[model samples]
Target: MKIATKKIAACAILALATGLFYQESARAAIPIQQWKASNGAQVYLVESHAIPMVDVQIDFDAGGRRDPADKAGLASVTAAQASSGVAARGAEPGLDENALGEAWADLGASFGGSAGSDRMSFGLRSLSEPGLLAKAAQLAARQLGEPAFPEAMWLRDRERMAASIRQANTRPSTLAGRAYAAAVYGSHPYGFEVTEATLARISVNDMKALHRSLVEPCRAKISIVGDVTRAQAQTLVNTLLSRLRLTVPARCAPLPPVAEVAPLAAADLRNIPFESAQAHVLMGQPGYKRTDPDFFALTVGNYILGGGGFVSRLSSEVREKRGLSYSVYSYFSPGLHAGAFTVGLQTRPDQARQAVEVVRQVIQTFVAGGPTDAELQAAKDNLIGGFALRIDSNRKLLDNVANIAWNKLPLDYLDSWTQQVEKVTVADIKAAFRAKLQPEKMVTVILGATP
Candidate 1:
C-alpha cells in the first residue's frame, strides 16, 4: 500500500510538471470575475476551460508580521502544522499526518499551507472532474479548519528545524543576510529572526489561538483559475471553507494595524570576520509599499538598474567591466508595509570593497540622472515583450489573481499591465528612485571580508 501511494504521488507531481493538467491560450486579455462570497470572502476567478484542472488559493491576514516578538516563527509554524493532522469530528475519524498524506496521494490531488511576510495562504490543485474535485475540496477543508496541533509532531519538527538552523549558521550568506536584515529593518517584525529560543516559546496552544483568531471565513480572499465557471467556483469555495469553526461575523472587523517599517535615519555598516573564501556584501534601505503609486516606475527602473540580468547597469559595471564578482543583483520586496530594497553580491575578500564601491557609484548615478532614452526604451520593450510569460500557466495566473484580490487592485490590472510599463518615462524612473531610495542612509553588511 505504501509503495502504491508513493507511485501515485510521484505520478501526480509528474502530471503537473509536464502540463498534463491544463493548456495556455495566446490571448493577452484575461477578464477577471470578482465577487464576494456568501461568507464575506472575496472571490476572484479567471475561467479557462482549455483544461480540466483547477487551482485555488485562499489568503488571509495571518502572516509573519503578526508573530509575537518572543514567538517569531509562530505564523510560519502554524501554517505548516495545519496539515499535520485533522482532529476527529463526530463519527468521522481523525487522520494522522501519514494518513493525510496517503489520502491526498490516493486522490492524485495536492493541498498545502504557507505563510509569507504579509499573508498566510492555503492552495489546492485538483482535476475539475466533479467527483474528484468534491473529494479534494472536502479533505482540504478538514485540514484547513481542524488541525490537531499534536504536541509530539511539534517537538519533532522543532528539533529538525533547529538542526537546519545550525547548519545554515555556518554559511556566510546566511550570516550576512541576517545581519543585513537587522541593520535595515531595526525593530520591525520583518527583521525578526527565528532563533531556537523563539521556537521554544511557541506552544501548541499558541498555534491554536492564532489559527482560531485569524482564520475566520470572512477574512479570506479566494482566487480560482482553471475549468470552473462562476457558479462552480462559488460552490468549491463554500465547501473548502465549510469546516471553519468560527461563525461568520455581522461585519468583519479590521485587524490591528502593524507598525510600518521605519526608514533608516542614518547609514549602518557592519563587518564580520570569517574564514570563507568569498565575502558576502549586502546594501540598501527601506523601499516603498506594494500600493505605492511609484510601483510601476520602480519596477521599470529596477530592470535597467540590476533586475534585467546581463543587460543591467549593475552587471555591466560590477561584473563585466571590473571582473570583481560573477553576479550582482538588486531588488525591492514591497509588501503590506515598506519592504527592503537590497543590493547583494559576493567576491574575493580583497575585491569586496571594490565591488561595493562600483555598485554604490552605479546606483547613485542612476538615481540622480535616471536611465537614458535608449535604456528606458530597452527596459520597456523587454518588460512588455516578456509580460505574456508572466501569466502563461494556471499557477502563475492564479497568483496574479490572488495579488489583485489581496491588494485591492482593479479587475483590469493584468490587461493594462503592459500599458503601465510602456508609459513609464525616464523622468518617472528618476523621480521614483529619488523619492524611495536613500543611498547615503542605506545599511551595508560585509561578512568574511578583509580588514
Candidate 2:
C-alpha cells in the first residue's frame, strides 16, 4: 500500500511512522482490530478495499517445536492433513482433501499454508463473494477442532514422507542441513528433523495424541486481511470459533531448555566425507528471536554482509573477486526461540577448505568492522524502497499479518517497517552484529573431501 495523505490527523500520524516525507492526501491504514473469541483464540483483523478478495490465516503453536522428541514430524503431519481435509475424519461424506479443494475451486478460492519451527499455519483466500467466507470458515473450523486423522491418508502420507526423507539422506546438501541443525541446536526442539526411523515409529494414534495437545485455542492466532469490513470479519470469526472446544491452560506450557544457549565462544566444526559433484559448506551460530529489538539491525546488516546477493560482502569477496563459487549467501532465521545465522555455499572439492576459510575470514572481518557507511545506506535504501512490494498482494499481506499475530508483534509493525529500517544507523548495525554474532564459536558443516 502506498503512503496515504496526512490531511487526516490519524492518517498523518501513521504516515509519519512510515518515515515518508512526501505530502499526500491520505496514508495507508494499519487499523488492526483485535479481540479474543469465546474460546480464547486471538483474532486480528485488517480491512483493505484495495482488492475484492479476502485472505485468512490461522496459526497454532503446533510446529516442529511442539513435536515430541520421539515423534518429530507429528505436528507437521497433523496440520498438513487438516488443511487437505484428509485427516479430518469427521468431515462430510466424500470430503477428502482433494474433494474439499474441488469445492473451494468451485467458489473461486484457494486453501494452503505451511508448518514451521514454531507454527502450523493454514490459509484461505477467496473472492469476498456472498457465501464464500462462511463456507471456508466452516471447513476450517471442523478441520482445526475435530480432525479424525483418517488412517488411509495417514498411511499414504507417512509412507510418502518416509521415502522422501530416505532419498534426501543421500543428498550431500540434505545431510549437511541435518548435520548443521543437530550441531547448532544440540538438544533444542529446533534441532530435531524427522529421520526414516522416527517416521516409521510414528503411528496414526501418535499424530492424534500430538495434535490434541498442540492445536488448542489457547495457542491459536487468526489474521484476516482484505475487502471485508471489521464487523463482517468478526461475524465470520465468531461463527467459525463457536465450534472449537477450547480448554485454556492455567499457563502456557514452557519450552524445553536449549542444551546450548550461548553463541559459540569457540569453533564447533563437523566434516562429513561424501562423494559429491561439489562441496557444500554451511556455517553460523545462534542468532536472534523474532521479538529481538536488534532484529532490524541484524536483518539490514545481513544484507550488506551476505543477504544482499551479488552486492553483499560475502558475494563480493567469495565469488566476484576471487571467483571461488558462483553464489554465496547468509541469513538470520528468527524462530520461536533463537535461530541460527547460517552462511552457505558450494564450490569445487579442491577449493572446499579454502572457500570455507575465506567465508570465515569475511564473517570475522565484517563482524569486527561492520558494514561501510555506503553499504549501510544502500542496504537501507534498497530495503525501504522495496518495502511496498512485501505486502502488495492479498496473499502477501495475509502472510505478514499471520507472522505479526503469531509472533505477537505490534500491529503497527508493518506501518513502521520503513521508518525502522531508515533509523538503523551504521553504529546500530555494527554494534548489534558484534553483540549477537560469534565467529570464534561457530558451527561449520562441509560435505565433500576433507583434507
Score every model by TM-score.
Answer: 0.96, 0.88
- For model 2, what is the alpha-carbon lDDT of residue 185? 86
- Candidate 1 matches the true fold with a TM-score of 0.96
Ten contiguous residues minimizing lDDT sum, candidate 1: 19-28
The Cα error of candidate 1 at residue 192, in Å, is 0.6
- Highest TM-score: which candidate? 1
Give me the candidate number with maximum lDDT. 1
Q: Write the per-residue lDDT of candidate 2 for residues 1-451, one digit (tens) a residue.
A: 0112112223423433453331111236467788876566788987876435677887877788767788787777777776546332443554676777666555555566578888888777665655656766766666666666677887888889988987988889899999999888887888898987777787778867766776666666889987798788877776655555557552346545434344555787888899888999999988988889998999999999999999999999999989889999999998868899999999998898899889999999998988899998999999988877676555666778888888889888888988899999889988999998888889999889556
Which 10 consecutive residues of model 2 have the lowest summed lDDT?
1-10
